[model samples]
Target: MNGSQALSITDRKADEQAMIAAHNCAVARSFHSYFNQYILTDHERGYIVIDEGDYGALPQHLMDRVVDAVPSKMIDEH
Candidate 1:
């Protein structure tokens, strides 16, 4: 609603579910999800997708590193 007027990426439980499904689909087939990607939508702002990597290869120690690298969460607050 401000600046670029794009919607926000308010991630959801379904997003997590889709991630699981995609992961399962990938593993059951050929190390790749049948969908290869899933999206998060904000009707006003738009959408975002997740469809990369092999099962989100996250190591225990790297959790903080990855979390730290994500963009700001206050995008829609203003």
Candidate 2:
């Protein structure tokens, strides 16, 4: 669905739930170092920033999934 189109109440809530689930799953699977330094600014706009030392440890696939789960408009492509 396009970003501008308003989601139904149910759809909006479901999306919110999915994002929450995704965030929880990511945290559970991620290393403790990630949590220590990570900050979740928004479910959509912000992303987890791994410290330089831990960056390579994160699985690329998981990162991709998290990015996909986030609202497209909120992602900072730059």
Candidate 3:
């Protein structure tokens, strides 16, 4: 690949790693107990609700990855 393209890939990887670290930190801090629950709902058009009261507005592609990575479920009763 070209130099610019390779650099872009590297930069994207770094950004993704940073985001994952941040998400882990946030999840750990919010859930005090041993078991933590997270929910994903459409907040805006591109954003999603992560662990009630916390929202992350990521790109559509990134949103898909986040959804896949996190354990999410719907509460029909609520």
Q: Write down the TM-score of every candidate.
A: 0.28, 0.38, 0.34
Q: CA lDDT of each candidate?
A: 0.39, 0.46, 0.45
Candidate 2 lDDT over 1-78, as tens digits, reads 687899899988876776566566455544433222232334464444333235544456545533432211222345
Model 2 reaches what TM-score against the true structure?
A: 0.38
* Cα shift from native, residue 25, model 1 (Å): 0.2
lDDT of 2 at 54: 52
Q: Let me know the TM-score candidate 3 reaches against the reference structure.
A: 0.34
Supply the global lDDT for candidate 3.
0.45
Write the residue-wise lDDT of candidate 3 on 1-78 in tens digits: 765555478767865665566557546645443222333333342223244324444446545545423433333343
**Residue 37 in model 3: shift from native, Å?**
13
**Who wins the lDDT comparison?**
2
Model 2 alpha-carbon drift over 4 Å, by segment? 1-4, 32-78
| Candidate 3 positional error at 71, Å | 13
